[model samples]
Target: MALTQEEIRKIITPLLLSGAKMLDRHCPRCGSPMFELNGRVFCPVCEYREKQKKTETGDVEKILKEKLNELASSLPEEIDELEKHLRVMEKIIELLERYKKLEGVK
Candidate 1:
């Protein structure tokens, strides 16, 4: 069903009141303007959720790398504590690699 302009406005009003941003990009399905709210990008008219931009992933990857470096430099002397630290470092490396792969695609 096609929503009237009034219906669209009704849907968007609360978001705007709560500080959701109206984005410049339009929806592929309905061509209605998209919005960004609480880090989520979506089209209110079509109710379609958009994937977050790759730049956001890049930022996450950088933070994980920095944390991994910090953990490495502060390694614990105890074997059990060292093992726990190594496990966390491994997870961070895994996340960094995953983000790198995602950035390669569209």
Candidate 2:
């Protein structure tokens, strides 16, 4: 039921190549013909727009990493809270177990 990596690649490569050719024939941004530059896709006018968009939002991965670092720094405090909550839960479970034993029910 599962495809091997090689088999998946074999099936996907033609589709990818075809899609690239189609994209070269038709631009994704404006539905105009795409001009290839050094094997990279570019629509001259859209390129400036894309750059502006990037400037507006910056790199996604870098932003994600900065957020992740902020969260990671807070994790020790969160873990301490979680451990306290877990201890409370364990106490509740022990009381339930003792109640069941007193009731002579399994």
Q: Once model 1 is optimally superposed onto the true structure by TM-score, how far is the C-alpha of residue 83 displaced, in angstroms? A: 0.5
Tens digits of per-residue lDDT for model 1, 1-106? 4557675767778778989999999878777778999999988766522233455676798889899999999999999999999999999998888887876775
Candidate 1 lands at a TM-score of: 0.53
Model 1 misplacement above 4 A: 1-52
lDDT of 2 at 88: 56
lDDT of candidate model 2 versus the reference? 0.51
Residue pairs in candidate 2 whose N, alpha carbon or C atoms collide under 3 angstroms: none
What are the TM-scores, per candidate, against the unseen true structure? 0.53, 0.28
For 1-106, candidate 2 gives per-residue lDDT tens digits of 2334653365435445665432437545555445454577665445545555555444443554465455445544567886765565566556555554644541
Q: Candidate 1 local accuracy as lDDT?
A: 0.80
Query: After best superposition, candidate 1 residue 45: deviation in angstroms?
Result: 15
